[model samples]
Target: MLDVLKPVTSLKLSTKPRGEGAVFKLHYRATFVFIMGCCILVTATQYIGDPIECLPDKDSIPQKVIDTYCYITSTYTLPKYYNMKVGVEVPHWGLGPEMAEDEKVYHNYYIWVPYMLFIQAISFYVPHWIWKAIQTDKVYTILMGLDNRSLDEAEKKDKENLLVKYLALHLHTHNVWAVKYIVCEILNFVNVLVQISITNAFLGGEFTNYGPKVASFLWQDPEDRTDPMYEVFPRVTKCKFWKYGPSGTVQKHDALCVLALNIINEKIYVILWFWLIILSVISALALLYRVLTMVSPSFRARILRQHGGTLRPSPLDPSARDAVDSLVHRCQYGDWYLLHSLGRSMNNLTFLDVLRALDRELNRSHSSDYDLNEKNLLKGKDVTSV
Candidate 1:
C-alpha cells in the first residue's frame, strides 16, 4: 500500500522539451529558472502543516533542500551500505519535529542516550577541520621568566631540544596534544570507512537503491467529536481522535517530529552528515601523517636543530649557508633595536636619562653642569654671565 502511494506523494521537479527545435531546447533552461523560483516560493510558504505552531512559512525548507542534495549525492555516489530512514535506520528521532511526528518517538531515557550522544559528538567536533583550513593568522611569542643575561650567557639559552631528539621535531608531532585534531581524525576515518562500504554495494560506479526522505504532518485530532478540522489534513486529527476517544489510553503526541521529518526526508540531514564526514576524514589524515613522523627519533633530532622550521639544513648543503644568511639578514634588518640599546648604554642611560634626552630635544634642558634640574631653569644664558 505504501509503495504505491509513495511515488505520487513524492514531489518531482522535471520538465520535458515540447516539439523540439534547437532553438526551443534553449527554452528548457528558462524553465529551470522558473522551477527554482517556484520552489523558493512554495518552499518559503512551506506551511509546517501541523496545527500546533502554525509557522508563518516553513523555516526548514532550506534545511530540507540541503538534506536532499546530500542524500542524492551520497546515494548516487555510494548506495549499498546506507539507509536513510529516521527511526528505523538511525534509531534516533529525526531532527525537525514534523518528520518524526508521523514516525514514532521513544521516550525511554536509556534508549535515547547513545543516539543523542552520537549527534552531539559530531556537532561538537566538526569545527576543527574548518578552523585548520584557515589557521594562518599572525602570532607573537614572549620570552617569560626573564632573568638578566649578557650576550655571552644568552648564547647558552639555545639548548638542544631533547624532546625533539626523542621524537621528531615536526609541528604535526607536537600538535598531538590538541583535542580537536584527534577527534577530527577519528570521525573522518569512520566516515571514509562507511563511505567505502557503501560504495562496495554499487556497481559500474553507478548507484540506484537511494530514495528520497518522506515528509508528512500526519497526526490525529485530540477529540473524535466528528470534527471538521479532521477533514483538512486528516492525518493530524486521526491521531487526536484516538487520544480523546472512548478507550482513553494516555499517549504521547509530537507535532514537531512530523514537520522535522518532512524536511529531513526531503534532504537536509544527509547533506550535513556528508560534509561533516568529509571534514573529519581530511583532518584525520593530516593528524596521522604528523603522528607517524613526530614519534620517529631520527626525524625528531633533525627537526630540533631548525628550532621549529624545515628538515633540509645539513652540513654539506647550502641550506645551512642560506639559513645563516637569512639569520644574518634578519639580525641586520632589526639592528635598530640593538643599535638603540647600544646607544642607550653608551650614553649611560636609564629611564631618567631617556626622559632627560627627550627634554633636551624639546629645548627644555638641564644645566650643562649636570647639577641643575630643567623645569627650574630660566633661559640658558640668564643663569650664565652673558
Candidate 2:
C-alpha cells in the first residue's frame, strides 16, 4: 500500500530552486505534491478494491449488477433521516424509504474525485510554471560564479569586478523582471481562491463551510452530534435502478450502497480545505510585503540593511551606511530586488564587497560625466572668443 505512493512522495522530496520564497514554493511544491498524493491514493483504492458495494431490496437481482449500477449512476442520502435513531426509526442514519418530495444530497463527487484532484494539482502548479517561463536568470547569470566559494582569489576578484561592471551598466533595467515575479505571486493567490470556489462547487457547495463545521462537530453533545464528514461524504447512500420483470412488468429496485471511497475522501477534503486557507493567508501577506517594499523606500532600505546585518554582525561604518542608502535610492525596485536576491546567494563578505565596488563605479561614472561637460563648456568659450 505504501509503495503505491512512492512517486507522489518523491515529488515533495525533490529539490527546487531557492529563487522563490517558502509560501510560493508551498503552492507549486507542497500543495501540488499533497493533492497528487491524494489523487494517487484514491485512485489506488478505487482500482484495488470495490469502492462501492450495494445490497438491493430484491435478493433475486445479482449483487454484482447492482454494485456496478450504483457505482456508475450516482447515490443519494436522505438528510432528514440523518438525525433519526439508527436501527429504529431508520435502518441506518441516512437510509430510508424513497419519497417524491424529500430532498436528496447526492454522492456524485466520489467517483470523479481522483480526476478532479489531478486537475487541481495541475492548477496549483501553473502559476509556478508561468513564473519560470517569464523570469530571467539574470540575477544568477550576473553573479558570474561569485556564489561559489571554491574559486581562487584572482578568479574571484575577476568575477567580482565583472559583476560590479555589469550591475553598474544595467542598473534600472530589471523592473520588468521584478514585475513578472510579482505578477506570478498574484496569480498564485488568485489560483488558490479559484480552486477554493471550484472545489466548493464540485463538492456541492459543502467545502466552504467544511472546516468550521468539522471543528464544531467535536463540541456538540454525543446524541446531538452529526458527523459533518458524513454529511458531505456519506458512508452510505441510496441508488435506484429500473428494469423490466420476466412478465414484462416494470420493476423499481432500490439498493442501499456503502461508499467505501468516501472514507478516504472526507479526510482528504477536510485537510485540503484547511491547507488552502493557510496558503491563501500566507500568499496574501507575501503580496502585501511586496507592495510595501515597492512603495516604501524605507522598507527596501531596511531589508538591505537587515540582510547586511545578518551576513556581518558588525555595524556598518557611517560611509557604508550612506553608500547603502544611496544605492537603494538610486536603483529602481527591480534593481534592488535583484540585489537582495544576490545577497542571499553570494558569500557575505563578497556581497558586501560587490556593493562597495558598484557604488564606487556609479560615482566614477558620474564624476567622469561632470568632467566631460566642464571640458565641453571650456572648449565652447574658447571657440567663441577666437
Best by TM-score: 2
lDDT for each residue of candidate 2 in 332-370, tens digit (9 for 90 to 100): 999999889888788877888888898999999999999
lDDT of each: 0.29, 0.86
**What TM-score would candidate 1 get against the native?**
0.26
For candidate 2, which ten residues in a row score worst on lDDT?
A: 10-19
Looking at model 2, residue 190 earns an lDDT score of: 96
Alpha-carbon shift of residue 249 in model 2 (angstroms) = 0.9
lDDT (Cα, tens digit) per residue for candidate 1, span 337-380: 22122222222212122222322322322244344545346556
User: What total of clashing residue pairs does each candidate reach?
Assistant: 41, 0
List runs of model 1 lying over 4 Å from the truth.
1-240, 243-261, 264-266, 295-317, 320-386
Q: What's the true lDDT of residue 263 in model 2?
A: 85
